[model samples]
Target: MSYDKTIAQAARTELERRRSQAQETARLNLEGFLSRCPRAVEIRRELSSNASEAARAVVSGGEVRMELEQRKARGLALREEYDRLLKSQGLTRRDIEPQYTCPKCRDTGFVEGRMCDCHRALRRSIAYRQLSTGLPLESCTFESFSLDYYRDDPAAMKQMGIIFRTCREYAENFRPNSANLLFWGATGLGKTHLSLAIANAAIEKGFGVVYGSAQKYASAFEKERFSREAGEGTAGDLKNCDLLILDDLGTEFPSAYSNAGIYDVVNDRLMSGRPTIISTNLALDGLEKRYSERFASRIVGGYAMLGFKGRDVRVQKLNR
Candidate 1:
């Protein structure tokens, strides 16, 4: 999957930083160890010289095998002595070596000409972080959501309880091709909160998630529409993300282009069998009136509706 240049650059820079830090840390550790144990330093020097001698013997071609075998024996003895010195100080060989976060790539972000898993993960995380910017992802978890705000009406309480449990289960069992969801309710009814919770879970499970308010994405689509350049848009990210969370679906400024763009995104994701969660203040009737019968009907048929019923939680909090 392709990410924006900024995201990719940031990931690469971070990986390089990790690699340098590991090397610097190892160098410092070795310096400290040498300062404490001078004899170990001498043994290390002897081992280095033995390796150089072995190399020279290989090229000199005078009883090469015997000379190489002698050098190897001396090198092995020097190594044993070095190990003994380290053992006396309660240290091991690896203690003075660079300990990278990923041994496979040594924090280089690639191995054998292929991008490392760690590198891909870093890019995905950076992209998700950028896409989810300004949203309270850390605080919008299922555990932090309160049921106390829905206590005003019995029907509302019962409906909210079911919605909470169902949302939690959906997040827990989320997969790439999981069922699409429509969160229909009024403002502050926990629709956005639950959708963000699902995004957090999917990200933790290593799925690439793109989350944004409808207004934000609509503005992106509008901006990208006029800019007729290759690789110059956010729509690709919206369509290709493993999971998409479109919050406040009916809130964006309406236009022919924006509406069609939104419809295209929804339809493309649906056609590709990718899971999407759409939280909206619009009910079925409101959705049909705003978009089209086809758009509304596609949602109605494909998405499992989770009706949110409760007093405005934000207002409740403010009152308290």
Candidate 2:
């Protein structure tokens, strides 16, 4: 999957930071151990001297095998003594070794010339974090969503409860092949909230999610279309993200390029079976007029449609 360059860079930086931190921790641990047990320092010095003496005996060629065996036995004894010292101080050999975040890669982000699973997960996390920056992810969780807002109308409340339950279930069971969702409703009907909540849940489950308004994506497309920046294709990131949530779909300024771009993203994700959630103020008929009959039909037929009905809760909140 394609990722934003900045996000990829952030992941690399994180791996580097982890490597440096692990090394620093090991350095500090060794320093502490030496300070606590000066005998460990003497043992290490003796081991080094034994190695130098073994090299000298090899050069002298006088009973080198016997000399090497004696040096090896002495080195083993010193190692045992070092371990005893460490154990006396409530430490082990591992205590002075670098503890990498990813044992597979040792925080190097790669193993045997291939990207490690930990590195891929880090990239997904960075991409999700960068994409979710301006979104109200923390506040838009299922727990924070209120059925109290629709209480004035019983039918609205009931439908909203059902929608809320379905959305929660969808997020709970979310996978790469999960069903697409089309949230069609007026503004302030909690479509964005539920979609974002799904994004949050999916992200917590280690899915790569990209959530943003349709207008925001359109602006990105415009920049990519006109700019000279290399390898900065926003459409690729949107299409390849594990889950894409597009809010206020009908609010973006319509143009031939943007309309086609949006269509391509929707169609590509649909064809690839990558689940998407689109929250829009447009009905099926309105969608047909704004885009094309084929695009509208594709959405209406392929997506699990949820028509939200309620007064604008933003105004209600203001009055309350």
Candidate 3:
């Protein structure tokens, strides 16, 4: 269960904020309660003194058992009086205590030296939100992808059904070293939709996924080349994410730098044995011509090719 460092840090920061807010609220509640009832303050002081005296009795030794018993009785009496006073004021202990969002960990993101489930959930949510920033992740789930679009053509419908099942199974069983995937076909044939669907599943399973269009990535790479600070971390993220989805692969503006950038990212991930899913409107020959023979060969040899088949779903929808 690996997560991006930035995402883990963000989760920690959020947990810290929750803890602070809970503590602050608790302090204000206690302050207000003490202000309303002066007797409660006296009882609180007596309870503290009783605890100190019990500790001293243990160290002093003579008649320690008896002295400790007396102090314990005094402390219990003080607590009972405090509780009765709170009841009179229509309050309970919880009303003056910190109310943490995750009580099991007290908003600390951990329990007994281990990461809590709440923390893991928070990281997954943050990762998903970050990936969905410019993408339609919520709408591109497997359940929402309709086979009805290809119903008119029997051949197209059969092919799409198999492709859909394969993509869903791949996502369900995805691992760090899972096989790479290439989605190749014409526009609006459900390539990008399935790619994002896979991304959504991988993220839900706690894998870091970087998803974006090839054009967007190319622009980031080109900006990084000229400016030292621009997109400094973008290349690293692209290479290191557990799953990378490069959508519309042939849509980027043609340039030497963008070509090299795309090649580097694809080659690096392949060499590292990390899984990647790329959707392209280009075929083998088009990929070879647009990038290079080597780039095309790497993808062909390493990726499980899924050739999308169907009329343009977008066009079909618009016409309808």
Best by TM-score: 3
Backbone clash pairs in model 2 (N, Cα, C under 3 Å; residues 3+ apart or in different chains), count: 0
Rank ordering of all candidates by lDDT, starting from the highest = 3, 2, 1
Best by lDDT: 3
Give lDDT tens digits, candidate 1, residues 191-245: 9889989988888777778887899888887887867568636777778878998
Per-residue lDDT, model 2, residue 94, is 81
By summed lDDT, the worst window of 10 consecutive residues in model 3 runs over 226-235
TM-score of 1: 0.82
Worst 10 residues of 1 by lDDT: 1-10
For all candidates, what are the clash counts? 0, 0, 0
Candidate 2 Cα errors over 4 Å, as ranges: 1-4, 25-73, 80-96, 110-121, 124-128, 228-232
